[model samples]
Target: MKYLIPLLFAASPVLADAPVVENITYSDGRFDVTLSHGDTGWDDYADGWRVELADGTVLGTRVLAHPHVNEQPFTRSSQIMVPDGVTQVFIRASDNVGGWADDTVPFSPN
Candidate 1:
């Protein structure tokens, strides 16, 4: 799946909205990241989001299905076991056509 997301998005339009990290909530060992993107439809939508270490270890990912056209920006959470002493992680979003958004959301564990 890691190699497939980018290829899927690359086939779509280039003008699609980039996904943005709007909010993050950390509890215990889990996190909830809110993503904002312009979801056009099945052909163009925010496909997924993930939390990873700066070194590129993916902690968790939220897979989105269909398009949240009416919702505009939406929130979703992924639960993962974070290692002890790891204070921060990066959040990334992807659209069907645009692959990964250019912005990486940096979040600190709370």
Candidate 2:
């Protein structure tokens, strides 16, 4: 049953710690935000991710109606309209099965 043991371990789900906003870039009338997480596999739960602006304003949130099977680093790029006079942005994530987590990154508009 040694093989069974390994199989079971592999089948177990890996819970991602949380997601964070690593950086924000503003150029050419576009806003590009990057996200990083302890587990890149969290893309499977991308629907639970969200982006919010300072002062509790939500910019955009994940809308993953279906599970994402991306096999890359734990990062995502989004194109957004640079909010007027926005100084900072917040990134939030949730697992539908639990509460939410968020991180804030400061940036300057072009």
Candidate lDDT values, in order: 0.81, 0.54
Which structure among the candidates has the greatest TM-score? 1
Give each model a TM-score.
0.81, 0.50
Q: What tens-digit string does per-residue lDDT give for candidate 2 at 1-110?
A: 76999999899876665545566565664555455443334443444555576677777665434333452223444556657776566656654333376445556654
Q: Tell me the tens digit of each residue's lDDT in model 1 across 36-92.
A: 777777888888988889988888888887788899568887677678888888888
Sliding window of 10 residues with minimal summed lDDT for model 2:
66-75
User: Per-residue error at 13 for model 1, in Å?
Assistant: 5.4
RMSD of 1: 8.6
Deviation (Å) of 17 in candidate 2: 0.6
lDDT of 1 at 36: 74
